[model samples]
Structures are given as C-alpha cells and as structure tokens.
Target: VRPKFIDYYCPYTLGGHFINACNKDGEPVCGIYVKVSVERLNDISEQDAIAEGIDTDWLAESQDNYDCIADHNMSGRPTAKGHFSYLWQSIYGDDKSKCWEKNPWVWVIEFKRVQEQRND
Candidate 1:
C-alpha cells in the first residue's frame, strides 16, 4: 500500500523514533497516516471529492484531462464529483479491477495538510 509507494512519491528521511522525514533535496516534509478505507469509486460523494482536492484547482495528481474539468461536467456532474470521476477514470481506466465503469473498490486515504514543520 502506502509503504510501497510513499518512498517513490515523497522521498523522505526518518528521524528515529521521533518520526520525522525530509525529501531527496533535504527539504523537510512530514506526514503521518491519517486513515484509510475502502469504497467503490462511483460511491464517492461531493465532500469526499472536494477532500480529494478537486476544488483547490488540482484536478488529479496525474491529471492530463483538463477539458473534463468543465466540459465533461456539463454532462450532469459540474462539481468536485465530476473532477474526481475524471481523475479516477484517468488513473484506473485500463484494468477492469480498477476501472471507473466497474465501480471498483478502491483504498481511500484521507490526509489533512498541516502547517509545515522543521526538517528534523
């Protein structure tokens, strides 16, 4: 799960039992596991979609389907939910086990961004 991917994506260093980390560039970064759950991709709600960061202007972490943000929404979504759908589809469209049309059960991780701390 996150343990497999966090290293590749975040690249941090641990601070002993103190539980701290920094990036490859030595810029301090820290995160603690908040929570993780499983849900159908299609069951995502507006609040969850917003929490996924669609409203903040970042559509998807790997989003290249920007047109869907506004244009696809005209098809009856028109909100954070719409953006999230596009993101999900983009990320998991190839495999039936992860496909949006299949409404696959996906691990949902909730992270709360806090104020930056030292590079400890």
Candidate 2:
C-alpha cells in the first residue's frame, strides 16, 4: 500500500480595516484573503513503515474520524466557521466553544471525498 496524500483547500480571511465615518475615502482595507493548501498523510501506516524500512506493526493506528484540528498540541490555530465547529455542533450537539476548549486538536471537518479528490 502506498501513502495517499490528501489536499485540503482552506479558505481564510484576515481582519480588514474598518470604515471611518469621518474619512471620505473608502475604508482602507489591509488584510489577507487567501487559500491555504493543507496536506494529510493517508491511513497507510503499514505501507509507510515498509517504505521507510521500518517495522510496520509498531506504527500507530489511524482513527476512523479522519479530520484533525488545530490546537496547542496540534496546529494551534483557531477553529474557523464552516469548518470543524459547525459540523461538530450539528452532529454531536457539541458547541464550538466547548469543542474549542476541550478537544481543539480533533475538531476539524473531514473533507468530502469528491471535494478532496476532485473527481469529475
């Protein structure tokens, strides 16, 4: 088995300048709006081990819930809307605030197969 790498398109926007009532010019916006490409190593522990010339049995098993969150131990980033929190709250009755505080590391949204693979 080979390691199946997955790509995620993460759309993010930074805080932009606010409109000032006194200023006649439009609000000076100074922020970043961009998409980030995130990659995930597929559930191929045994394959990875074999390819790396290491013992396969010792590798840790992958979790069924494939999404990974950003937290202190992990990515350490805030959970954005329409990503992890939204899904968790909808499915598990887990609020975004609670998820963020409790298990931020695993509070990510899984990529839809079609969205991730982009198969036509």
Candidate 3:
C-alpha cells in the first residue's frame, strides 16, 4: 500500500510506514508521501497455488472505519510466500500507542515486504 508518508524507522526500504500527528518526536520529520492505490483483492486456493479475484468480505466489516478497508486491501500482511506490501499504524506522538487504542475490529496492521527479505 502507498502511504501518505513513510516512517523514519520503517522496517522495509521498498515500502513506507504511517505516522500519526502526535507520534512525531523532536521536530516534524518529512516522509516519502505517495498518492497511488496499488492494493488489490485476490482469491487463492490451496489446491494449485492459483490466485483469482473474488468478493472481499472485509468490505462489509469496514463499516466501523472507511480508512480501515482501504488499509486492509492495500497493506494486508504478506505470508511466507507472497508479494510486496506495507503496514499501517497510527502514532499520535506519545508514549502510548494511538493505533492500539482502537476497537478490536479496527487495527493498525504490520507491514511485511517479501521483496526486501534478506537472502542470508
């Protein structure tokens, strides 16, 4: 998923992270902001490792927060064998994590980009 801005401590170099307003420390740090949608929905099967597009169930569950649905489709976590990706989080510039202060249904997901995995 293309985030509005990237975090300085981003785990992945290819992709970026999301930082909340309060999460900023010291001074306001700039990030790599992107304005594109690369998120997709795919249906994969265990039979043949085939992937196809199907209706996303998460859409219905996204009524709580519209941004959640977009984040899910965009930065869904990557499995042991998957494609490029990133995670979304809300940092309100404080010791307490703002992202974690959401309902159980809502979540600030962790990004995992397989493309950046180390060969060693």
Candidate 4:
C-alpha cells in the first residue's frame, strides 16, 4: 500500500530516509529529503502548478484558436492553476473524494538530487 505522506514524517515514514535511483546511464542519484508538507489539491499555487508541468501556453493558444467548448467569457489565457485544474479533472474525473473540486489533502515532497559516479 502507498503509505500517506505523514508516514514519511513519523519514525515509520521513509521521507527522511535514504533512497537510491539510477538514470539511463546507470549513474547513481542520491535522493536526499529536503522538505515535506501537505496542501489541499485545489489550493495549489501557480508556481507549484507550473512546477508540476502544466502547459499554460497550450491552453491559452488552443482556447484562443479551436477550443469551442471553452467558457465564452474566459479570455483563453489560462493561468497555471487553471491549466492544472483542467488536467486534474482529466485524471481524477468527478470522483467526489478524489477530484480536484473536493480539495483533498496531498503530500508534497522536496528532495535534493545528487548524481554520483557508479561505484562499479
């Protein structure tokens, strides 16, 4: 089971623990926990939305060009949160407990990526 982010905080959580990963070249990546927090899904910030890889440009351009379903009153310039909300719905659908509109608590983990040479 996927333990909640809180599990990573308590002695039981692996948030602050050492985790290893490798890139395509098999170089070791030292993943060190830097921070962890929780936030409501709908309360995401523009910065966080962008960091999560929302494409505001495409939303705006498509809305301005061929998106007949877009809200007529909207100017088609999608904010980061707006774009993210659209993507969120696509993933979660309208599930009452999990959809973005329900504003569920989510885990936020920040880590430092340090790549090291392969030992072997």
Candidate 5:
C-alpha cells in the first residue's frame, strides 16, 4: 500500500503520519507507515510507489501537505492562525494536551479478512 500525507505534527522527527485513504469495498483502507526525512519527502512521489506496484488509490485522494515546527525543548503555543491552523488542532482542538506536538507518533492500523461461522 502507498502512504499518503494525512496531517502534520511538531514532535515527529521526520515526515508526519500518513494514512491509506482509499475506500475499498466501501470501507476505509489503511496503509503501511514509513518514517522519511524531509529531503526524501521532496524526492519521493506517489507515482514512484505506484510504479513499484504499491496501490496508489488510497494515496491519491487523501494527501495533505502542511509545515510543522517542533519545540522539542519547550511546550507548544497556539499558532499564528489560531489554534485550528494545523491539522492537529482541527482534530484535537481545545485539548492541547492531545496535540501531536506533545506526542509525535503515528499508528498504522491494518485490516484483514477472517472466516465466518456457518451452521453445521
């Protein structure tokens, strides 16, 4: 699966968390999470992964691009554009404690099929 930019956070050392936004079987699809350097972010493209056989459907539709600054040594303050300027703020507004800047990590959820039970 291909990774698409979902949002940005300050604490992340490299690129922010990405999610596979493809709707398959009418359900949201999830992709693998990869840590990439800022330089690499500019160098890589979804097309490259698609050419390499990774599904691009999920990536093409849900890519978000935003800049994040990390105040690793001190607590975070509201951004110039209000607290909702960043994706993190939009997701967890007023609840600054849950902001990604405070905890920079991405969770990639994977889904799999399972057999169903039948009458004997």
Candidate 6:
C-alpha cells in the first residue's frame, strides 16, 4: 500500500490551549507540530485521516520513545534507510511557568510499517 502524508499541529500551550493563551509578539500563539504518514487511516474510513488527524498526546512523548528508522533524512537529501522521515517541532523553557519564553526544538523521525503477507 502507498503511504499518504499529512502535517498536524498541536494546540496545547503551557498556560492554555492555542489561540486562547500563549502570546507571541502580542498575538495568541500556536506551536508544536508534526508530520506523519497515515496510510492506515484510509483503511478504517475515507475521512479518518482528516477527522482523527495525528495524535498530539502520542507525539508529545519524549523523542527517545520513538525508534529512529533513519538519520539526517529530509527532502532532497539522500536517505540511508527509509523513504521519508517524520518531522516535529517543540520548545523548552527555563521555567515550566514561563514556557512561552522558551527555546525552539525540531525533530525528524523515520519509521517503517511492515505487514505479513498471507497465502491461501
């Protein structure tokens, strides 16, 4: 099966949810994002991918939680392993209370989905 790609954004901020809180440059801020392939989403329903989207809570987990399928993999770059890599964004603050005043972090992930073929 061919994989369908999607990009998702997380609405959660330390103070509150996106737009409601977290001010950036005098404007309500939205941060934290991810890129993933949901080839399996179509199997359940045509609109499943669009409706369910990415799981923000799962993506929020520590980077160590995910196994790296590839490294330094990106568009136009030669991939040593998988065809595509996952991408996500995050930020770290000096104090948990001041998450708005934080440093930005980005991640690219690589993974593969394997299925067993059945013969009758």
Q: Return the top candidate by lDDT.
A: 4
User: Per-residue alpha-carbon lDDT of model 5 for 9-112, expressed as tens digits?
Assistant: 53644456555455543343543435433332123234443443443343234323222224222134323322122444556654547563454443322334
Candidate that scores best on TM-score: 4
Q: Which candidate would rank higher by lDDT, 1 or 2?
A: 1
- Location of the lowest summed lDDT over 10 successive residues in candidate 3: 79-88
Pairs of residues clashing in candidate 1:
13-22
RMSD of 4: 8.7
Sequence-dependent TM-score of model 1: 0.51
Q: Point out the higher-scoring one by TM-score: 4 or 5.
A: 4
Compose the digit string of candidate 4's lDDT tens values, residues 58-82: 6566634333236323453657776
Better of 2 and 4 by TM-score: 4
Q: What is the C-alpha RMSD of each candidate to the true structure, in Å?
A: 8.5, 19.5, 17.7, 8.7, 17.9, 20.8
Candidate order (TM-score): 4, 1, 5, 6, 2, 3
User: How does each model score on lDDT?
Assistant: 0.63, 0.33, 0.32, 0.65, 0.39, 0.32
lDDT of 3 by residue, 16-94 (tens): 6444432234333333333333322222222212122222343334454445445445455323112111122332322
Tens-digit lDDT string for candidate 2 (1-54): 222233443244223523233223433223333433433323223343254343
TM-score of each: 0.51, 0.18, 0.15, 0.57, 0.20, 0.18
RMSD of 5: 17.9
How far residue 100's Cα lies from its native spot in candidate 2, in Å, is 3.4
How displaced is residue 7 in candidate 6, in Å? Answer: 39
Q: Which residue segments of model 1 deviate by more than 4 Å? A: 1-29, 56-77, 94-98, 117-120
lDDT of candidate model 2 versus the reference? 0.33
Instruction: Give residue 106's lDDT in candidate 3 (0 to 100).
Output: 27
Tell how far residue 51 is off in model 1, in angstroms.
1.9
Quote the lDDT for 26 in model 1.
62
Q: Which ten residues in a row have the lowest lDDT in candidate 1?
A: 1-10
Query: Which has the higher lDDT value, candidate number 3 or candidate number 6?
Result: 3
Select the stronger candidate by lDDT from 1 and 6: 1
Comparing 2 with 5 on TM-score, the higher-scoring candidate is 5
